[model samples]
Target: MKTALLLSGGMDSIALAWWKRPELAFTVDYGQLAATAEISASAAICSALDIPHTVLRFDAKALGSGDMAGTAPDPNAPASDWWPYRNQLLVTLVAMKAVATGVQRLWLGTVASDGIHKDGTPEFFENINRLLSHQEGGIVVEAPAIGLRTADLIRQSDIPRSMLAWAHSCHKADVPCCHCRGCNKHFETLQELDADVATGD
Candidate 1:
């Protein structure tokens, strides 16, 4: 199947890109605090991989909450970094783009750690895939690393350190703040794999 990956410029997605080497990749700028950094890192990685990269720019700052939006998460919020229906929105957007390009499948980077989120669960993917299968394009959504831990996926992908060095995980900074949950998990994943964490310039 002709496949494309949703590249988020994070460790798991980077590893997925390297392992699958998809025909193309999409990095959406959905107005997150890390959008600039994500686009930069994703572009760099795509260049290195010789994969076509597209940036879908949409200002959804109004929909974002918590650390990712530079606002404290609401105490009543279901998850700290939750944006209401974010994964569903993202998948829908990418699928719209994918259909135009004749992509049969779209890959998400959701790993085992992401299971905590309702939208990241296997059931969610299954339902979403069923929904897409009914659409005109028959675009399938797949999370190949959903069963693997971050470190395990990294080990399995064996992505080059040079390319991985460009992956950005901080939710609050253009460069890694090393304080956010994303950054912390990234560091821990690297340590677990005995890999060097890149110090972005």
Candidate 2:
């Protein structure tokens, strides 16, 4: 089946890309603070992997809240980086583009830890999958690493450190702030991977 990945240039997504090697990849610039860096990183990896990469641009900053939008977090935000319905919006947008390309499956970068947000849960994927499948395109959305942690996904993907280093996980800027949740996760995942290697895991 033809598959396409929502490549965000974050550790999780990058690892998923390397592991799945989808036929195509889509990077959406929804007016996020790190859109430029994310696009650059994603393009570089896609080039190296010889996967066709398409960038979809849509300005939704007015609809966003939290670190990614450079705005205050929504009152109901579950995390500092929360953007309401972000995953839903992104999945919908990607599916819109992917369906036209005859893509039968759309992959997300969500991992187990992301379940802190409702959208990142398995039920969310199942619900969204049903919603999308009920539509004309019948595209299925899946997150293969949803059951695993970031470090585990990295190990399973067996991505080279050099390639993985190209990921840009800063949620607040093109250059990593190192203080944001995204940056924290990036560093933590790397440390975990290093620890595993050192212990021969």
Best by TM-score: 2
| RMSD, every candidate, angstroms | 3.7, 0.8
Error of 1 at 143 (Å): 0.3
lDDT of 2 by residue, 1-201 (tens): 999999999999999999989999999999999999999999989999999999999999999999999999888899988998999999999999999999999999999999999999999999999999899989999999999999999999999999999999999999999999999999998998889889998
TM-scores for the candidates? 0.94, 0.98
Query: Clashing residue pairs in candidate 2, if any?
Result: none
Error of 1 at 134 (Å): 0.9
Q: What's the true lDDT of residue 55 in model 2? A: 99
Model 1, range 120-166, lDDT digits (tens) per residue?
A: 89999999999997889999899999999988888789897778889
Q: In order, what lDDT does every prediction score?
A: 0.89, 0.95
TM-score of 1: 0.94
**Model 1: colliding residue pairs:** none
- Candidate 2 lands at a TM-score of 0.98
For model 1, the run of ten residues with the poorest summed lDDT: 192-201
Candidate topping lDDT: 2
